[model samples]
Target chain A: MTIKLHCFGESGNAYKVALALELAGLDWQPVFVDFFNGETRTEDWRARVNPMGEVPVLQDGDMTLTQSGAMLDHIARTTGKLDGDRSEILRWLFWDNHKFSTQIGMTRFLMNFLPEAKRPQPVIDFQLGRLKAAYGVLDAQLKGRDWLVGRDVTIADLSCCGYLYYPEPFGFDRADWPEIDRWLNNIQSLPGWKHPYDLMPRAAAA
Target chain B: MTIKLHCFGESGNAYKVALALELAGLDWQPVFVDFFNGETRTEDWRARVNPMGEVPVLQDGDMTLTQSGAMLDHIARTTGKLDGDRSEILRWLFWDNHKFSTQIGMTRFLMNFLPEAKRPQPVIDFQLGRLKAAYGVLDAQLKGRDWLVGRDVTIADLSCCGYLYYPEPFGFDRADWPEIDRWLNNIQSLPGWKHPYDLMPRAAAA
Candidate 1:
């Protein structure tokens, strides 16, 4: 059976999986979960796929998978893109998912989605601090490098771009991160990057 | 030259890389970074390796990798541990690093390490909500399953174990997560998992 990914419309997390499938040149069905109507929270939806009641769950025959990072890794490995120095590539991929994506993504989500009245300044400040701190580190790492791992693009670049390019939504200024900006531009120029973005125009708008 | 990883001595992030090196059975050098002294802030260090100024930067020959998720992916790819159904494995690994490891690890860290007076309840609440949400999803997925991916252990289990087992520090009651607890117990029994915890006496104490 072909792989089927269940996710919400225009969700960035879901887009990550879609992007990976495109990059790996795999054909899969996209099952939309209506987040606005709370479709993901239904018992039936939760039982068959995600218990967490979250979007972006990939069902491959009998095997099911969750988490965007894992999905990206799975796609890369399955498609033979997880090549080159194995250890080196895996390390960068982990970093992207764990550090850059986690911290920055959290900041972006909060600053963009949370209502001003509900959002606390300290929380915003704390996330921004972490984001800047992470940027500083990323800037240094990208000094002479074009990609997070190896000469060619790997899931590391794809994973990082899942959140890095949407800084404007989080109110982060990209001008401060030249290296990241250059890297983002490089990934955007890739052939695979455009496929999913074109299919989901609203996702890229964010 | 042997692979050199620069990181703080007592960091879980750093430990992720160290654990990968140990599991991969590769020879490497560990460079201790002084977090209290603010050594990560040095321009030289930032310029040469990570601009994020975080620990656990792995340098092999001329290639340096930052971000623990990326690092793990690199190691797995390089060491040939990324086995089984490639996409399946990669998906779980990414999920472990991005969702499970990232959320659980951060929640645990803040609750355990940060001073009570300085800890933010909302952040804790947010993380806790996310954690429980993730756990519910994982518990459902793990029902009648041995590991997150295939029948055997993969980087996905390793990555999740790095954070999931230490729920106490984060004020998380394992009783609430029977599946995760069961899985954690299983992983702890493994020789690979035990090796690092045994070597790091301090971690055992915590």
Candidate 2:
């Protein structure tokens, strides 16, 4: 049975797992969640699909999973590819969720998705400052290394790179971060690597 | 060997691990990180401690672990307490990191820790809205349950409850969320449970 991923393109959290599945060579299909239309916030969607009301919920046979970090770990653990030192990988995954992707995801949504007049400028500015600090941390860690964790690419790399591939301006400029830029290139050069927009069906209008 | 936790009381992320160590009956000592004094951002601190420049780093024997979610898993795995369904536990742990505590941690810092004049009003209002949604999700999940996962309290409980126990307000009022309040009570009822401030040395001035 092919694994089903309930996701939308705008969510970098969802893209993390999709990229992992594709790169790991797993049989997976995308079921788009109309996040722009407030589908995730609906009562039926919350009750039936996810109580957390978030995307990137994966169903593989009897097991239904949410949380992109956990899904990435599951894909890596089951496939035996893109797997590495568990503790180290988990550390980065947690950091990405706590400090990296989550911040970027919200900042991107505020900057690009929300109506220009409705956008909170002060909030966006604050987030951009925070994001700059987070980017510096990632760049510093990537200095003298190709991947976030170990010599080979792992889910840690996949998790952190989720929001970086998008074209939307979330106050991140790859040219400004050379180490991160090179590290992203390393991920892009992977055999089956695909941009997030290419890997998942986007909810945003082209 | 005694575990050394590099943490400060103000960080809910650190409290998650400190609570776990205390509840797990581990011999642990708190090594305070002077976050307010800008210790974590220093080059020497980043080079010697965590490159992520965050707290709640656990050092036991030769192993040094950062990220509270990873450290919680480590404590649960090694001590055999607060362990539950791996996927279920991880799902909440990831959710807490990505949504629950991280948002509250930042919002609380902005609202309470930062100088009142320096606090950005728009950012606080925006974060408060997002936090209400997160609180609803957590409250709905805990509606009829004693804990976030399984029949007993686990790291998921510790992780989500990290910021909830704080005295400082970040727009969260226990009375406003009955389900979450009850769930917090259940965690409080746990034997050997200690408040975050009680478990770690506080860096902020009272």
Worst 10 residues of 2 chain A by lDDT: A47-56
lDDT of 1 by residue, B37-144 (tens): 667789987877776676668888878776676676667767887345666666666666667767776676677766789787878877777777677767877788
State the TM-score for model 1: 0.76
Candidates' C-alpha lDDT:
0.68, 0.91
Candidate 2 deviant stretches above 4 angstroms: none
RMSD of 2: 1.4
Query: Interface RMSD (C-alpha) of each candidate?
Result: 3.4, 0.9
User: Top model by lDDT, which number?
Assistant: 2
Residues A80-138, model 2: lDDT tens digits: 99999888899999999999999998889888999999898888888899999999989
Residue A129's lDDT in candidate 1: 71
Candidate 2 per-residue C-alpha lDDT over B1-206 given as tens digits, one digit per residue, 9 for 90 to 100: 88999999998999889999999999999999999999999999988888777787899999999899999989998888999988889899999999888989989998998999999888888889999989888888898899889999999999999999999989899999999999999989999999888888899987
